[model samples]
Target chain A: MAEYPDRLKDTLADFNFVTTRSERAELLIDIAGRFEPVPARIATRPYAEEYRVPACESDAYVWSERQPDGTLKFHFAVENPQGLSAQAMAVILDETLSGAPLEQVATVSPDIVLRIFGSEISMGKGQGLMEMVRTVQRHARSTLAEQAS
Target chain B: MPDRSSETLDLAQRGYAHPDVLVSTQWVADHLNDPDVRIIESNEDPLLYASGHLPGAVEVDWAHDLNNPLRRDYLDQREFEQLMSRLGATPQTTLVFYGDKNNWWATYAFWVFQLFGHDRARIMDGGRNKWHAEGRPLTREVPQYKPTRYKALPRDDRHIRAFRDQVYQHVQVNLPLVDVRSPEEYRGERLHMPDYPNEGALRGGHIPGAVNVPWSRAVNPDGSFKSASELRRIYESEQKLSPDDEIITYCRIGERSSHTWFVLKYLLGYDRVRNYDGSWTEWGNLVNVPIER
Candidate 1:
C-alpha cells in the first residue's frame, strides 16, 4: 500500500488529541482563517463549471498547478461566505498535499474528514467534505496518468 | 413600494398570520443589548459560528446540543433545562434563531425548542445570509454569560411532532403529507443522479399520498419568506391544501420539513401541522412502511 502524505499524517495526529467539540471547532476555525482563495493567475470570478466540486453546496472550486519538482500545488475557492468548513478543508488539502509525492497524496483517504470534523457532522456536510478530498485525489491521479502516458 | 427602513414594519405589511414570530435583521440589531433577548445561531456547518457570528450570539449545535447522545431521540426535559442554563437563558429570555442555508437548520432548532414548549422564540427573517449581505457585524469573540436557572416543561411530542405509526395512520386516512424535498428526491431520482451519493435512505421516494411542495417555495430569493398571500397561492391554491387540514411534513431527516412545518403552522395559520422528524431516513429504511415513488 502507498504511504499517506507525512503532513496529512501529522495533521491527523494533531486532531487525534481533540477531546471536545469546542476545542476541535476552534482549531478548524483558526485553520479556516488562514484560507486564501485561488489567485487570479490560476482562475477568477465565475469559475468554470468543470472545476466545481460535485455535490458541494458550498460552491467550492479547485485547480492544480504542476510544481518544479513534479509535485502538484492545489488551489481552492469556496464561494459561500458561510462555508467555513470548506475553507478549512481547502487550507488543509493545500498545505498537506501540495508538493507531496503524487502516490502519497493519492493515498490520502476521504475518511480523514471524519477524523478531522468528527462524527457529529451532518450527513450532507460529511458527504460534501469527503467529495472535496476525492476531488483532490482525482487531480493527483490524473497528473500521474499524464506523466505515465 | 415597500418600506425599506425596518423589516419589522415591512413584515407587518406582508400579512402573515403570526408575523410577530418573525423578526427582521434590523430588529435583531436593535435588540442586541436587550437583556431579555438571547441571540442563537444554528447551522448545518459546525464551523460557521466559530469562524464568525453575529455579535453577542451563542451557538446551539443541532447534533451536540439537541440530540440524545446514545439514542436517536432528542434530549429530555432535564437535558433541555441544562442546555438552557448553559445558554444563560431563563424561560423569560427570548431566543432569536438564525443560520445559513436560508435558516434551514435554524427552523429545525426552533422546532426542537417547541418540543420543550419554548414559546418565546423567534426566527430572524432573512437568516445569516441576509445579515451578511447587509454587512452586519460578525465577530469571532465568544461571549460568556452567567448561567441562569431555567425551568422547562416535559417535551410535548403530542403537539407538533409525529412518529412513524402516526404517519402510517395519516396515510391510511388519506390526510395531507407534504414532501418538502427537491423534485428529484420526491420522485425517487436522487439516488440515481449521476455522481451524486444517496442521502442515507435504503429506498427512495416519499410517503404514500404525499404532495410535493418543495419548501423553498415559501421563501424569496433574498431568504426572507414570501408574503402570506404568495404562500397561500402555493400551498392553498396550487397544492389545494386547506388551513383546516391536519398536515404532516417530512424530508430526508426532517430538517427541511421543519421549514415547511413552520410555514404552515405560523405563516399560513394552519391549525394542525406536525413535523415527522424521523422522515425518509427512518421510513425508507423501515421493513414494512409504505413508500410511493
Candidate 2:
C-alpha cells in the first residue's frame, strides 16, 4: 500500500482518461512543454553532485527543500530542452511532488510511469524515467534527512 | 574537424548506383532558397527538430507520417498522398532529409519514401551533426509554406521490404542475412544496442545463420558513409558477399538496418537487398523461433 499526493492522485486520474497512444503522447508533450530552465541565479550555482540525476544522458539537475510547513519544494533543470520524454518526466514529477509532503513524495512508485506511458515508451527511455524518479527521490530523502538532523 | 567545408567529400563523384541520392551540406546551404527543394529533418528523437535545424527545413515525425494511423503498418497510399500534400511536397519536389545520429532516421525516412515510390528523395550526407560540426547556421524559426496538391504512388512492400515469412524462408534456404546491429547484440550478449535500453524481448541473440556486420562499420565516427570503394571492400571483399546475392539486414527496431540496406542497395549497387523492418524486436519475441547464440 502506498500513499500519494492529492495533486498526484488528481493528475493520475486525469491521465487515466487517456485510453489511446495519441492521448498519452499528447499528455506527455503537453507536460513537456511546461519544463523550462530555472532562474540563472540558481542555475549558476555549482549544481551539487547530490542534486544531479545520474545517467539521464541529458544532464538533469534537481534539488529539494523542506519548507517550514513541512512540505517539499523541487527545482529541476536539464541540458536538453528538446528531450520530450526526459523533460516531461522531470516536469511531471516536479508538478506532482513539489510542495507535497515527504511521505507523498516518497510514495511515487516506479509503476506510476508505466501506468501513464504504458508500453508506448521505449525501454531505454523507461529506464531513463526510473533513473529520474530515483534521483528526485534521493533529493527528497536528503531534504528530510537534513531537516531531521 | 575540417575548418574548410570544401575539404568535405565530393558526394556527386561517389559513382553510386543512385549518386543523386546524396547531397552535401554545402549544397544544402546553397539550396536554402530553392523553391523546388524541400528540406525535411527526420530524427529518432521526435522533439530534436524543435531545438534547432537547418534553415527553411520542416520536421517530419516518422511515426506520425509513416505509420498507418489505425494499423500496425505504414500509412496507406491515400494517407501518404494526404501527408505529402499537407507538407507542400508534390511528386516533382526534391526532398532532402538530415538528422541526428548521422543519418539513421534520415535513411529510414528515405526508405519509407522509396517504399511509396518517391524516387526524388535524397539524404544530406553526414546529417545534422556534420552540418553543425562545420559551424553551419541553425535556425530556431520553423518555416511555413503553402501546401501543394500531391499524389503518392501505390505502396509497394516488395523488392525493398522483407516480412517474417520471407525472412524465415531465407533462413531455411541459408540466403545471406546481415545482422546490422552492435556486435554484442549479434552475439546474444546484449538484448539491444549497448547504449539502447533492453525492450524485454523473451529471447536473446539473433536469427540463426545471420552474420554480424555492425551498421557502424559502414559509417564513419562523424556519421558519414565511407567512400564507395571502401564500402565495396568492406561488404564484398571483406565479408565475402556478392552484389548479386539476395540480402536482408535487421536490427532491434529496423532503423539501423535500413541504413545498411541503403548502403547496400544504393551505395554498393546491390540489387537484391531488403530491410526486415520487424528485425530482432519481432524475431526475438516469437515462441519456437530459431535463435543462435
Candidate 3:
C-alpha cells in the first residue's frame, strides 16, 4: 500500500475532531476564504479547456507547476463565485499536496473528499470534489511518467 | 445581443399564474426583519450557508434537515414539527427560500415543506446569484431565534409527490411526463463519459413517453424565470402541453424536476403536477422498468 502524504494525513486528523456541522463548516469556510487562484505567471483568462476539471459544476480549472525540487505545486480557479466548497478543496489540495512526493500525491484517495467534507455532501458535489482530487493526482502521475520516460 | 438585465421582466409583469409564490431580491431585502417572514437558504454545497448567505437567513440542508436519517423517505410529522420549532417558525410564518444553482435546492426544500402542508412559502426569484450579482448584503452571522412551539400536519404525498409505481401507472396511461435532465442524459450519452462517474444510475436514457425539457430552459441566463409567454411558447406552443394536463416531472434525484414542477404548476398554472422524487436514480436502477433512449 502506498503511503499518503504527511500533510494530508495531518489535515484529515484535524478535521476528525470537528464534531459539529457548524464547526466543520466554519473550518472549511475559513479555508475557502484563503483561496487564491492561479496567478497570471502560470496562466491567464480563457484558460485552456484541458485544465478544466470534468464533472465540476463550479467550472473549476486546475494547473500544476513543477518546482526546482521536482515537486508539483497545484493551483486552481473556481469560476463560480458561489463555489465555496470547490475553493476550499482547491486550497486544501494546494497546501497539503504541493510539495509532497509525487508518488504519495499520486496515491491520494479521492474518498478523502468524504472524510474532509463530511458524508452529507451531495452526490454531484462529492463527485466534483473527488474529480478535483483526481485532477491533482493525474498531474502528479503525469509528471512521474514524464520523468520515467 | 440584448442586455440580460434589460431583458429581465419584473415578477408582476412576468404573467405567472401564482405570482405571489415568487418574491424578488428587493422584496427579500425589504423583508429581512419581518417577523412573519423567514428566509431559508438551502444549497447543494454544505459550506455556502456558513461562508456567506442572505442576512438573517437560516440553513436547511436538504440531506440532513429534511430527509429521514435512517431511510430514503423524508422526516415524519413529529420531525417536521421539530424542524419548524428549530427554525422558530409557525404555520403562519412565510418561508422565503433561496440558494445556489438558481434555487434548485431552494425549490426542492420548498417542495418538501409543501409535503407537510406548509403552503406559506415563496421562492426568492433569481436566488443567490442575482442577489450577489446585484451587490445585495450577505452575512456570516448565524442568527439565534427562540424556538417556536409548532404543529405540523401529516405529510401529504398524495397530491404533489409521485412514487415509482405512480410513475409506472402514469406511463401506462401515456400521460405527459417531463424529463428535466440534460439532452445528453436524456439521450443516454453521458452514461459512460471517460473518467466521469455515472450519476447513480445503472441504466441511461429517460422514462418511456417522457419529453426532454432541461430545467434551465424555464429560467433566464440571470437565473430568474422567463416570462410566462416565453415559457408558454416552450411548453405549450413548442412541446404542445396544455395548461390542464396532468404532469409529472423528474430528474436525477428530483431536485431539478422540482424546479420544472414549480414552473409548470405555478408559472403555467397546470391543473395537476407532481414531482417524482425517486426520479432516474430509482427508475433507472429498478428491475424491469421501461427505459427509452
Candidate 4:
C-alpha cells in the first residue's frame, strides 16, 4: 500500500518551511475534507499588493486619530518597504494598544479570537491580506469618526 | 520669559504623521529653517557629499562614523562620543540624517543615534535623490559648525551588537547568518570596497553558510519600505526565520547591514539581532576566515 497520503500530511503540517510546499497535497486534503469539492485555492489578484502606489506613500495615511472606543491611534513608518511585514505590523499595533488592556482591545472582536491581541494580519492573493488590512483600516476610520462625532 | 520649554518639540510624541519608518522630504524641507534642527549628510562616497548636500548639513563618512578601523564592527564608546560632538549634536539637539546612496548611510546613522540614546532622530525619505529631485536647497561648500557638548551615553547593553568573536561563536553553534548583499556579492561575483583598501581582501563570495536576503529586496520601487504586515510575511514566511533565534545581518560595507539591522530590531521587533559592521570589507580582507562562493 502507498503511504503517500501520510507523507503528504506530515509535509503539509511543518510550519517551519520558508516557502509553503505541498500545494497538490493541500488540494487533495481539501477535496477529502469538504463534502462538495471546489477550486478554492485559486488567487484572484495577480499582484499581491493592489495599489500602483502604496497607501503609505500618500498624505492620506495620517498618523494620529481616535478610535471609536476613545483610544489613541499612532502610526510608524519604515524607510524600507520590507521592514513592515503583516505580522510585524500587528506587533506594533499590539504594542500601541498597551494603553488599553489586551482584553479591552479585543472586545471589538469575538471573545475567543479577540483573546489573542497580537494575531497576524493576513496578506495574500485575492481578499486575503488586502481584506484584512481593509477591515483594520475600516474599523479604525469608523472608530475615529465616531469619537469625533 | 520666552517659553523655551514648549519650544522643545518631541518629534516622537507627535508620532511622525508619516509612520515609524519614513520621514518625508516635504517635512524636512519645511523644518529646515528651524534653528534647533540639524541635518547631517551621511554618505559612503566622499565625492557625492562634497559635490552636493542639503544646505547647512555636516558630512559624516559612513566608513568612519559607524565602524571601528581596528576591530571592523560598531565604534567604541569613546570614538562614538567624539563623532557626536564633532557633528555638533547636543543631548537636546534633533538630528535629521540622509545619504547619497539610497539612504544606506542615513539608516546606519539612525541606528547610531538610537544606540546613543538620541530619540529625536529621523532619516529623510527617498534620501538625497528625493530631496534634490523635489528642488530642495543644497550647497557644495562645507558649512562650518561650532562644536557642542554632545553628551553620549551609549546604551551598549540594550543595543544589538556582535564582535568578531561573538559571530564566530554563533557559526560554531550552526546559527543562521543573513547576508543583506547583492546575490552577486553573496555568490563571489562582486569584489572590492568602493574606496577602502583592497590589498589583503579576498577575490569574491560571502561569509560561510550565509543566506543572501539583499537589503534592496526590503524596499519598494520608489525607495519606500513595504507595509508592516507585508514585511513580516517576507521575513518570517519567505526567509523561514523564527522570532526566537539570533540573526546576524551583514553587507559589503556596514551601511546596508545597518538598514536591515534597523528593520530587524525596531520594525520586526527581533530581540537578538546584530549588524556585522566589519561585514565583507573586513571579513574578505582577513587571511584565514572562512568564505563561501
Candidate-wise lDDT, in order: 0.90, 0.79, 0.91, 0.56
Residue B245 of model 3 has an lDDT of 87
- lDDT, candidate 4, B179-246, per-residue tens: 98778778887563232233225557877777888886665555545454555667778888766869
Candidate 3 regions exceeding 4 Å error are B1-7, B192-199
* DockQ of predicted model 3: 0.66
Residues B114-206, candidate 1, lDDT per residue (tens digit)? Answer: 999999999999899999999999998999989988989999999899999999999999999999988998999885222323337778888
Give lDDT tens digits, candidate 4, residues A1-149.
21222322342343224232223223323332322211124222232342221333211121323445565443322232222222233333334342342233333322111112112111111112232334344545556566569
Residue-wise C-alpha lDDT for candidate 3, range B143-260, written one tens digit per residue: 9888999999989999899999999999999999999999999998875333334347788999999999999898888889888888888998989899888899999889999999
All candidates: TM-score of chain A: 0.99, 0.86, 0.98, 0.24
Candidate 3: lDDT of B108? 94
Name the candidate, 2 or 4, with the larger TM-score value: 2
Give model 1's docking category: medium
Could you give the interface RMSD of each candidate, to one decimal?
Answer: 3.2, 4.9, 2.9, 22.5
Error of 4 at B92 (Å): 2.1
* Steric clash count of candidate 2: 0
lDDT of 4 at B101: 50
lDDT of 1: 0.90
List clashing residue pairs in candidate 2: none
Weakest lDDT window of 10 consecutive positions for candidate 4 chain B: B2-11
Q: Could you give the TM-score of chain B for each candidate, in order? A: 0.94, 0.93, 0.95, 0.79
Mind giving the per-residue lDDT tens digits that candidate 1 earns over A1-149? 69888899999999999999889999999999899999999999989999999888899999999999999999999998788899999999999999999998887888899899997778778778988999999999999999999
